[model samples]
Target chain A: MEPVLTALSAGTSVDVLIAALFGSAFGLVFGAIPGLTFTMALALVLPITFALQPTAAIAMLLSTYIGGASGGTVAAILIGVPGTPSSAASVADGHALTRAGKASLTIATATIVSTLGGLFSLVIMLFAVNLLAQVALSFGPAEIFALVIFGMSTICGLAERSMVRGMIGGALGLMAMTIGQDPIDGVPRMTFGSVQLLQGIDLLVAMIGLFAIPQVVETLAGHRAGHQMKIDTSSIKVQLPTLRFLFSYRWNILRSSLLGTIVGAIPGTGGPIAAFLAYSQEKRLAKHPETWGKGDMGGVIAPETANNAVTGGAMIPMLGLGIPGDPATAIILGGFLIHGIQPGPLLFTERPDVIYTVYFLFALSYVLVTILQLLGVRLFVQALRVPHQILALIISVMCVVGSFSIRNSFFDVGAMIVIGFFGYVLQKCRIPLTPILLGLVLGPTMEREFRTAMIMSEGSLSIFSQSPTALVFFGFALLIVAFHVVGSIRSRSAGEARPA
Target chain B: MTTPALRDRWTGLVILLVAIAWIIGSEYVIPSGYSGSAFGPRTFPTGLGILLAILAVVLIAGTFRRRDTLPPPAPSDAVDEPAKVSTRDEMWGAAATFGFLIIYFVAMQVLGFMLATVLLVATFNYFVLGSRSLVTTGAVALGLGVGVWYLMGHLLGVYLPTGMLGLGV
Candidate 1:
């Protein structure tokens, strides 16, 4: 409180605030656009922040991060296309509401609930950073590896098609991660002579190519406006959820928030999985579970809240442990490098100013997004009215430029074109790309930690099982697998009992 | 791919053969030296090859173990058999995009970023959107090509290529 007050009294610069607002608005627009994710938005904005004051820079980036994560709900609700993977579950009920002509209500509810949830976690995250930092300092490679295993176990929970297929997908991702250099040895194993291959596959290139490019192709090819997606201006009201409803489902929301926070605290798990798990939990707990996929307000709120909360939750590990929470935070970590501020446990002691600025940024995201919600709902919906032809053309160009811009090399553009085509093929074959993205993001880190831990312990499996924290996480992973196995068997048997 | 178990088995065999080729390429072609010596770069890819082979075997066995759900009969036979009709056009479009991309890659090196990106985006857009307006097409092509050039070159400070005229600056 004292630090925040000091910073506030240091002078409230309108310039910084306006810059933050602009960044947030851009993030909002990018986020609402299908295929441009929070991470991509952050990466695009990161290099640009090289020329701003540290406070303004951090503030703008943080606001954009929050805005982008929350903004995905708009596309998810209206077009049945999740703008970001975090908002995928939102499409279930969100699009249903749109089909039922309550698109405005759904969007408003998502925006407001997202803000509240973000603010809630932001406050807690700010106050508890010290304590969380203390806990994070205790984690080592074994604990980290266990956490990765737990994250990988989420494939069982998230696989919509079949558990076996999901495991296969995750295994394939693990294999893909193994394609680069061996972490301990620094041995370049996978690169087949091409200088570009030695640096290993860039996950950003893979992600954009996989998620963004395919969507461009699909939209261009299908080119169908399924229904007239109209937002009733008057219906855009953020009604407070009923007291009775809150009391009834308080436990679930709290649990989901905690789930999101914990996952966020473990760097690289990110928001999509958090939101998916929350929605799954909500569905499992609902009195009428059938209402979930159709159009349940609770379904919309649960994941929205959990996903937004992830912004603050992710910061916990990033600021405390110097580990990035996702591709977005990885870029933010790069921002810290530009500012000559090394982010780790010492960052708090060395530069409380930057830390305070980060806190202020979180608060400002709430303010900016809430205001944007009030003002720009109509404008945003109208922008979505752009014809598919123009949008596809624009996005494809952006994809090419974005890939090339990453490195001065034309090789990256070539990589993007290749990966984009691969993604298209994968989509046609019904292979999901999210797991592949997960592989690219977490793969290298997981392999390094696993191998280093193994070599340190002289190839002993006990290292993964010995530590209490490791053992606990390992147990949780097994429990998740067991639960899914039982659930699938039960569902299959029930299906067998019923008439076809 | 739309064939019976035997056909699917053959497809899996082909995929397995391709996986083997990829493994060989990674092992023989990739330079082994970087930092560590005892366990070099080729270890993981080699291991992955083994794993893939094992998995392929399992897949083959699984294919054989499963009871084949053959299409029952025509609709006139009192049962509406599940239609296995493939969306071949979508598949071909996807393949064509891949082919186009290969051409774009070659063209990028020769024709440069501006021309190649414009042509690629315009051509892909035409095929995908089927937008026939020449004026609209030209505008889109220019908009995309120049927009990318300005954004990457000026705004982001990314150094893209300047082929032939050397006009990237």
Candidate 2:
């Protein structure tokens, strides 16, 4: 009780509160801008945070990190652009609602669910940090490899036409990841002496190219607005979701929040992966599974909720152990070090004040951003009312700016253009983008872990079975594949039996 | 692709070739010596290449056996299948958009962000939107091009190419 009182009092200072507010708004802009990342947001702000008090400094970092993750939904829902990679899945259903004239409802649902999910993860992280940290550390190289495979199984759920196409997309992404220096060895496999190729294709370039650039082309083709009655979006009220309506999905919120926290705490996984995993789980559990990917409301809520929840979940590892959670949290970890605070097990006992400050700021930041999103929903939806020609023009330019800002290299911008064309072709072919993205994000990690395990076991396969964690995750991967196959067979037979 | 089945078949064959190329590429990987060597670098990519090849075969087989569904519906329309097929205007519209995108990429580097955006937006509205009003098109082009440049360069302190104008921002 003494420690709690002291920490709360310290966290309530004007400097700390003001810093939290500024961080939230600032990070919102960073997240809402397509191609700008949270890590960049943290690094950009670190210079000024040097002089502030320790608690205030840490508060700003936490708020910015939380705000950036939640703010991605605005662009994704309104303009069909993922403002941050974390919200890529949101584009699947949120944009559908936008085209259907239900943009306000979709934004409202996302805000309410995201806040609850974030708060839920914060509570678990605060109370169960110790136990979760142990489980996270136990994941060795083989276990990490198996986990990536289990994540790859999600390509099944994301497959639009069939799983085989999804595998091809996934494999292509993994192959693309092989273009730079090898993760295990320093080997440069696919670089063709351009020097730029040695650093590999930037994930940000690939994401912007795959997700946003295609929309520009579609808008030009008159595909942005579908054949639905145009509703007057300017005057619509952005109502807060009714409690009864939200309470109905209590199980989904709880389950996804838990999954988000677990995955985020595991060190290597980020919000996009968590968001997709949660989406797949919800789709599998839903009564009307067929409606997924066609603008289903659950698809919007599940991914948004899980991604926001990851803010706190990702923080657990960075704070409990010395390990950084995701890229954003890694930058925040740097912020901690700059403020002369070391974050590990000892820091919890030594500086309880700084730890509690992070918790309070996280809770406060989500509430602040959610309220901002709710209040500004009407303005955000105005994006849909803009002319297609103008919107496409703006988006294409922003895509250029986004890719350019990542490394300040002309080569990356050029790569984005080329990838945009590739994405355009794939979209025409109906090959789902999610599986390819999954492979890109997870591929390097998968290769590194697989090789490390093999070398440790002297290229023997028995290493996978020796570790209980590795064995379990591999088993889970096999189960997912088996279930996907069975489900496909049953659906096929049912379709064939119908009278033609 | 005009048809989904035909498209998937092509996609599968292209992927198979890419997988084979990837295996050949793996053999050339030379470690930079900054990191410790574990297993052979080719091991992982080779394994993935084989898996990819198998998946490509499966995708082609499935495409050959599956029924042909109707063309995908446009996002904005309600009618399941409109009588009007892909017309010449839509084809030209798509091509113009692609051309404009490439032009913008080059223009931004050569003419700078602000000027290039203005040029790109002007050309895009005239060609893609087919907007006839010069005043509206000019105003929007200038406004968006200049406005975004100001936000990204001045307000956010993010970089945008200055090109020839040397606008400082």
Candidate 3:
């Protein structure tokens, strides 16, 4: 409570409040753009944050995280482009609302729910991180490995069609991870003697290339080809949810928030899975299931709330255990490393003030986003109308600039282009890129943990059997795999028996 | 659009060939005794390659065994999807983009940064964007080139090559 008060005291200054607001606005625009994501936006701003005081740096990044998380709804509602993977589920309902001329309402609902959810998660982080850290402290390498397997298995659940294709995607990602230096050993495995390969591929460059640049080319190829629907601006006004409305669904919101926070605390799983799960549960239990994907308010609320909750949830493991929950957290970890702050158990004791500062920043960011939604909706909607060609050109230049800026190496740019082409090919083949991103982020950690476990066990395979935490995680992984397999079989069999 | 059957079979064949090649190629190069563990440099890759190969074979077999006939292509109005694109057009665009990148890379090597960026942007704008106003294209191209030169070379202290002219950009 004393730490919270100290952090809150600093937060009261107008300078700090403005900084938070400005940072959130920047994040909102960056996230609303089809190619840009929370991670990219955060990476671009990290160097700039170096010049600021520690509290302000954390504030800026926190604002960016909060804003970027919620900003995806703009693209989702307007263009059916899920800016971040977390917002992917929002498209079905959000875009339908757009088509029905309720874009403004959809955006408003998302904004409100997302803010509420973020606040809920921040509260948990403030009060419950100590308790959560104890649970994470007990996790062994075998348990972490099982968690990784569980994450990879979720790829099957996410695929649009076949589980085989999703598994193939996951395999390809795992293979790509093997291209860098061997994590356990100091010896380089796949560098081929190139000096640049020593550091392996920059995940940021790869992500921008894989996700952003491909979209640039795709947009250029079909410039102004999609339906030109006019955005109705009159509905941009914010309408607060009534107290009755809020209270009636309070349990759903709380349940989804809890679900999201728990999923987020688990390393490797984050927003999209949480959002999809919450949305599905909401629909399954609703009185009118048919309203889902057709502009139901609940449909809009569930995903927005859960996905935003994931931001705070992701920070838990990252701060307490030094394991990133997703790619965005991995990028944020780079910032922590840059600051010479080692995030683990020792961090809590070393920098309680910083932890409270971060908590203050995270909580404040939601307020920043809410203010923007009320005041800047018109400006944002107008920016959305920028021509695809111009957007493509700007994004292509940003990709080139960003890749080169990382190490001031032209070689990185070439790598970016190559990865971009590979991404283009994969996109054409209907492969989801999230699994690949997950694999890259988790690859080194998984390998290091596995090796450590092996060394400790003296080559015994029973290390997993010895630890209770490992056993529980292994059981969870097995259950997830079994559930997915059974579900797929049942679906296929049911399809086979369906009337033509 | 290609039939699902054809797509599956082709994907399987390509994956199988690639996996076998990868396995053989990796064994010859990567060392085996980097660490004392049961796994080595080759273990993960080799195991992954074999798994990928087996998965490919299963997918191909499933493609053959499954007899659920796909419905005929829907009418254009009923589909109401994004505009139907010709594969030929997409390929052409891809090839042109690749060609442009190669030209940009080589030009950067030979002609240096400033001149190359200007020419590349101009060509891309005129050729790719299909802008009719040559004056606007050239002006914007030169403007961006100078901006990048000043920003990256001078402001950021990056040592961009000055080419044969030695203008000290």
Local lDDT at A61 for model 3 = 75
lDDT for each of the candidates? 0.67, 0.73, 0.71
Clashing pairs in 2: A187-B31, A225-B76, A226-B75, A226-B76, A226-B77, A227-B76, A227-B77
True contacts kept of each: 0.31, 0.54, 0.18
Single out the weakest 10-residue window by summed lDDT for candidate 2 chain A. A222-231
Q: lDDT by residue for model 1 over A418-440, one digit each (tens)? A: 78876676555444555555555
User: DockQ for all models, in order?
Assistant: 0.32, 0.38, 0.31
Judge candidate 2 against the unseen true structure and give its global Cα lDDT, from 0 to 1: 0.73
Error of 1 at A38 (Å): 5.3
Top-TM-score structure, candidate number = 3
| Candidate 2 chain B: worst-modelled 10 consecutive residues by lDDT | B81-90
DockQ winner among the candidates? 2
In candidate 3, what are the lDDT values of residues A1-500, reduced to their tens digit? 78778878877676677668767987888777665577767755554454455666577778988888988887787777786778888899888888887776677778888888888888777666776556665667777676556656654443335666666666666667777677667666567787888777876667666666556666666653342334444556555666787777787788778878877776656788899999998889888889888877788788888999988888887777665666677666656655666565556766676677787778778988888965787777676665556555555555665566656577877898898788777777665665566566556666677777887787787987887777776677678667766877788788779865
Instruction: Check candidate 1 and list the clashing pairs.
Output: A189-B41
Clashes of 3: 0
Docking quality tier of candidate 1?
acceptable
- Candidate order by DockQ, decreasing, is 2, 1, 3
